[model samples]
Target: MSLAALINQLADEDTSALKTLSLVIDWVRPRPQETIASTLTRMEQLEAALTESLDVHLAVSSRLQSWLDNAQFFQLLSGLGLYSRRGFFKEISERLYERVNPAPADRNNVKDVLFLVFNRKGDDAWIHEVPDEALLKLLGTLWHFSPPALERTRIRVCTQILNAIEMLSIWVAAEELEPNILRLNPRVVDRESAFVALQRELAAFVQSYVRGLQDEDEIHLDHDHALVLIEQCRDEIARLQRRSVTAGSTMALTHLLERLSQTLTRIEHLLDILDPADKEKRTRRSIELFKTLVQASAERHGVRTLWRDNLRLMSRSVAENASDHGEHYIAGSRREYLAMLASGAGGGLIIAFMALIKIQILQLGLGKGVETLWVSLNYGLGFMLIHMLHCTVATKQPAMTAASIAEKVEQGEHGRANARKLAELLVRVGRTQFVAILGNVAVALTVAFAIGWCYTRLEGVPLISTNRYDYMLAGIHPWQSLALMYAAIAGVWLFVSGLVAGYFDNRAAYLDLAGRLRQHPLLRRLLPLTLREKFASYVDEHYGALISNFVFGVLLGVTGYIGYLSGLPIDIRHVAFSSADVGYAMSVFIPGVEAFAMFTGFALLIGGVNLVVSFTLALNVALRARGTRISSFPKLIRAWFQVVRENPLALLYPPADPRPEPLPDNHPHPEAAEAGQPPSDVTDSSPSTEGNR
Candidate 1:
């Protein structure tokens, strides 16, 4: 089918694509041995008659190729009459390579023509038969081909070349595209030098292509490949303007824009592919795309993870492009890409460990043991000291301040912060570090209590001996409690520490200060003025180490005191609450502390019942966090019955709703706006606004 015929079918003319396909099947597939010969004969006859009197060529090359694969050519001939549309080229290109080999000088010409044929809209009749590498190299070099100095060449030639470039991209990739088309075209090579001519234009084109792909998810990469094609056409305008500032420059740019207008149109094409009626197939495609990007080494740590391929291609193009143009290419690793992971992961783990031990020791009626605590705490602190020392020597964060963040934010134009009400899952990666810290703290408390319990039962001090069996409930002894205490302290501390280190090594943060300090303005945006801020944040994050070690020291101090002095016969209820038995004011004070920290373990026994009951005015100070000045505090307070009821991802990433990806403007929430601060506009269309765009 001709372009006109196909368009007519699309427009509901007498001929439709369905009818065209039906006709081909009826007439073409029957003859197996002589379909190609018959088609050729028919085309020759039509060409002869057309020259004599203009008439349609009654042979379809695209349909013929498709039939060649599955449908027989005879079947197509019976129904469509002579299918002569762009699809024929596509069919041919899929199955065969052009056997012809041209000389060095003619190589570019052949490739350019082939690209034009391959990019034909509607039915691709014969482009698929071309060799992949040869065709790709041809496609890569088109920017270098100089157009004829004619108005039509400016309009038709460039448009066709660009269209073809875009067309072939359906089979290629954005980042994988090569800019060597100009090299193969020879027009650029003949006139311009290797460094300052075609290479420069190729570089800029590469950047534009990559830039088009920005915000296009690498992981959820269901974006239109057609944009890559559209960009090829747009860059042609830029290429022409650079080639000749003399004439038609304005017209060329205008046409380029028109081509780009069709860019996003093909998103429908990809969506259809992803949302196929076959559910099994749809699932498979999603899985394939995810696996490819995830397992890709180019996306790993120590690599410039985000946009690395784009920059690499850009650099190559720039290197090959003209001197002035190549200067426009920018590429490097981003700064502070892994900071949040370090701070949250490192701090959370330590805190969890200490919290567990301390609470347990007190609850078990054991005084805090000092020796083991000091040893573990000291080791953790030493690591923090080293981490801080490294940051100090690096002098990074001050440079990574807001100005740097703004530049990164601009580049990440497509990413919208996932605004939502955060649950525990969002708040604490309890398993990652927060939970580890809490568990360790529990263990530490248990250890101190057990050791104290043993010391209290000793007949005498270490200088004097005592029976180890004093704590026997049945066969178990007091010394066994001390052993259990040691087990808790050593096991909890080491297990959490090692696990955190492994997580840091494996699932690194999005913006870690230490890892990212060196990469800014190159990999990430930076300001000389704010580099100091980065340094300061690094110092603050490292302080968790000091807090951790200090607690560790207290652990050892209590241990020493217990070993030396008999543990006083103390009841936790009396020490913690005081048996007024009347328990008047103590109820008020205890509930407050229990609600927040659950320190008394009574919070667990009653299940935050008292906390929920006593929640009052100050706690209700929150305004409606999101839109329309609607305050849902009462509803939210009631909802905590659920959060307090069912905690989720609390053990993974942060709990901030719209979990930020460790970049600037991380988690701007409804509370942020209510606090007299403008929330991050993720987009002008507030997600909840009535009729919001």
Candidate 2:
């Protein structure tokens, strides 16, 4: 309805206050595709119309006042804040349940009235989109039209705010006392600790504030000391988070810490809103709080948001572990670069034998299921052996190295110099990857060709039949086959395997697996003390890699079988294996030079897809988990181009005098420095030379 028409209707004595208020809201709301300026103009027009017509002004003023006076507000203050009284899992299930089956509204509660008035599904979207200045104007108009809230109502609201503070303090204290939190910070058990003192101070403040409210004397209460205590509690929470990096963290502990943090923040907001002086500031704070409550109510039933909110802490923990492991994958100096090449050569040698075994198994003429099982075991066991021998699979480096690069990007300061440093780091990563791939492809091809020649000479038959050779060539054909697509699939598995490795690493730390192994009675009885210690130490360091390699192999092996069962095209192609296949095919029958070049070009393309896909995926997750953004991307790209222009060979090979990159001042892992140990980047570790595949 038009503003004039709404004003005329509201001026009529027979129009109910509720219906009149609803009409005004409908008029003030933004129309579809309407600009915020247009909405603001309409709002001003409505306010002007009410000003001119005394009857309409009186109608809106009296009705809104009555509504405010009658509605209960405690639930609005305590319940609508971003918190829950239930446990994390229970809250998640309840939110999901409520999305499917909403509860009946409470007519007397202001919280319910908000949902009634903003009944549209996307009301929160527009409300959130509105600028703060526009919202303040709206609030000013409402305050001008409606009478001031009664003294009794003001007292009641203050009481509710105090009650909320009390409840939040209790929740924070209880969460802080959880066993996991105590393990992280045992000082929480002391009576003098911030967690305990916060509860005591809040109680005293409540009693004093309430007594002053009742007496109506000059109220003089300072919450600054209480705020200080809260800050200390927050520091303790931060300490717990830092300690969790080395001590390890579980989902339950993460959830508890997140809840405690939220509760403390809510308490702070309540205390700010409850100040008896500074009436104007209090009104502004209240309006801001109301907006927050509305937004929370709109999203209360969102399952995806709930899940994301709950998993954020745990994801960070896992990513932290992955980042630690990823540091070993980046080669900083010429020596490390050579070590990577040697590792790749070792892995390629093993992969050649694995490829031969796979071909022999295919020749068995077994059923699809049985063949898949044998191939999976061959790949899994081969990868595990490669890891044990400190070998490297060229394709697997991208997923791990990408995380290391992200850490650098995250730590970098925002400037041209930082961007240049990052670009230099990228150069190191690229050259390391290049040498590894070269080693893998060269060694695998050479070994496979020798094996095929030796077998044919001894047995008087070609190792690969002509028919099998054609099929293998066709499978790797760039345009004619799904080789690139299969390589992309393999890339995704590679990223998932990195996550699996991170998870097991976290599990090992959280469960104290090394400690358990060292103390196990069976190990003590079965082996000498030195052997047992060595075994436990080895397992602690290599457990995640061993498990990840096996799992990655299984995933690769099962894709084609899954495709066969479902009648779809699904498979994996690794560059090293494809190179071996090419060698075997050449041994069976020589192809033309063009065909051979085409085969090599497509093999490189497959490797490119594998690297790009996994690196992109892993880098995206690592950045998000760290809550870091490379806002200087354009500058970073420019820096990278400048480096390439200045020295193109730097990207393909290390410089003659390679130096180790120093750790940044704000390195994410500070525990090592604190322990008087060199940073992981500066020290060449055993894992640095091992296979990360």
Candidate 3:
């Protein structure tokens, strides 16, 4: 296994190169670290020399292809060696690609190119659209591919076939596989065949072969504990044994194929069951090897189709469950409760307007406040608009259970636009309507202000006035003439808040109901139907955690709030004030109307706000969780492979983790016999019912 030897030997006769490499792989394809390193360095130098001479990737590639064509050698390389998957893939990627893409126009050559990766476990690594993708990249009518040469094609193809016996073994194993033998996947179909011919072929070969080997002692070694390992020497060994052969003066390809035919027969003869180790250990190693091959070989050499098929399975599984959102995602808004808030504010705005208008009409008749009313309306409208904006951008309060519903639902290519539209819709319907109502609720106060001012002016004294306003703070009362001002403000606050809260709750409920109608598939069958099953599976998957998290937070928040309130010992009370308290100094005040208006407004506002907050929070949580059906499925399955992939464990098993990868690109799929075909249908084990909303 000298560097100079690999280069010199691979440099000549494609057919001879394949045979030599096959021998190198079987007898000395560097498996140990020291051997592998030296081999890589030598290969690198060869590649450098070939590049300097001109373009020799194809020449060198055909030589490597010759090795893959053999069964024993292909299996040894694809299935063994290396802690790093990436490194292994890099080593053989270029050569594999060249083997597959030898010549764009040669049907035999093109088919040969495709065969190089048919059974390899590197799909998650390479080959976007199969078949034509390996031979030519299509863009509209234009196609891209490298030039082809017939140099050593005959000899190379022959040697490649002889060398590929091991690969073929794996290929056969991969092709006729029992669905049950795959990853702990529930989506696998039972022995049903999609292609009749293929199915028959597999049945005939696998069954007959298994039965035929029953009498052979060397058929398997550790049938109970390991994969059967076996060897099959090529027919070339026979010709070499005979000593009546021509080494160089004949059609090399024909001889190579002859060797391939005989070697596979020997492999069948020598079948031995391979040993299996630790349960987790075997799977871990298999997956790790698969991943390494995928990475290094993906870009350069098209990845194995089966690997891509698996990805297609996993990807479709994700897409199926993730299409919709949950009930908890919908949040009730204080803004949507417009009608109720207006019950309070609408009265106030009218009152304020009328009184000011009356004063202005009287002044114009006598001549005197046009500019003043204009400025006041401007200020009031400005404040109202500002408040609405603030609510739209404001962070959720403590009781809010929903987390980023707007963000999650609005993902994908046009995610931003959809989100923007939803936000805008919310603002117009939810916040704007409510604000308008609140504006009306406070209108009467303005009216009271104008009238009181007029009355004071008539008496040559200040009418309704206050030193300062700490609206939420209770301190000294308002001025003597304006005692009604306090009542008016209280009226507005109580009524507006109550209305807003109620509407928030109502809207949350409605939106949640409406969201369900948007499901990808409607449940129109019995309880145990697939859709329901999928739904239940996902819900049940995370039910424990979701419940636990909810319960824990509820208890914590309640305990904390109660404790804080208990710490306060200050007296809290509200004093009742009437028109009599002010006497005639607040002369314009009618006690009955003032009290009636204030109490009614206060009652409605308080109730509304409470209703809105509670409703909004609950619905918000539900809406956010509605679409995640995976929670209904088997939770352990989600994370099984994931756990196997981290650190030390990753060295041995497939990652049984549940981290969902990003979705595929948004490009349109081509119209093929099976366009956008999702692999095996798997039912999730999550519970369909949800408590998130």
Best candidate, TM-score-wise?
2
| Candidate 1, residue 252: lDDT | 21
lDDT of 2 by residue, 319-405 (tens): 777777776888877788889999999998999999999999999999999999999999888999999999999888876777777
Alpha-carbon lDDT, every model:
0.30, 0.79, 0.33
Q: Against the hidden reference, what TM-scores do the models get? A: 0.21, 0.86, 0.22
lDDT of 3 by residue, 1-693 (tens): 554565455556544433443433322223443434443443445445555644244555554544433423333332222121233235346547666675442222322332333224433322221222211211111111133423333333323333343344544334324222221222333543222232233334444344434434434223221122212123222333222111111112222233333333433322221112354454334344334433434333334532343333322222212222211222234333433344335434433443344334433533113433443343334333333333211111112212233223334123343433333333332333244334443444444545555777799754422321222112213332222333333333322222233233222332332234324254534444566656654443333223322332233223323434577322111111121112212324334777545543442343244335433543333233222221222333334334333333332222243656553333222342145332223212323211110
Output the worst ten-in-a-row residue range by lDDT, candidate 3. 572-581
lDDT of 3: 0.33
The TM-score, computed over Cα atoms with residue i paired to residue i, of candidate 1 is 0.21
Model 1 per-residue lDDT at 239? 62
For model 3, state the Cα shift of residue 286 in Å.
22
lDDT by residue (103-187, candidate 1, tens digit) is 2322123222222222222112222222333323322222122233233232333233233333323322231122333322346
Error of 2 at 504 (Å): 1.6
Clashes of 3: 110
After superposition of all CA atoms, the RMSD between model 1 and the true structure is 28.0
Model 2 residue pairs with clashes: none
Comparing 2 and 3 on lDDT, the stronger one? 2
State candidate 3's TM-score. 0.22
Error of 2 at 575 (Å): 2.0
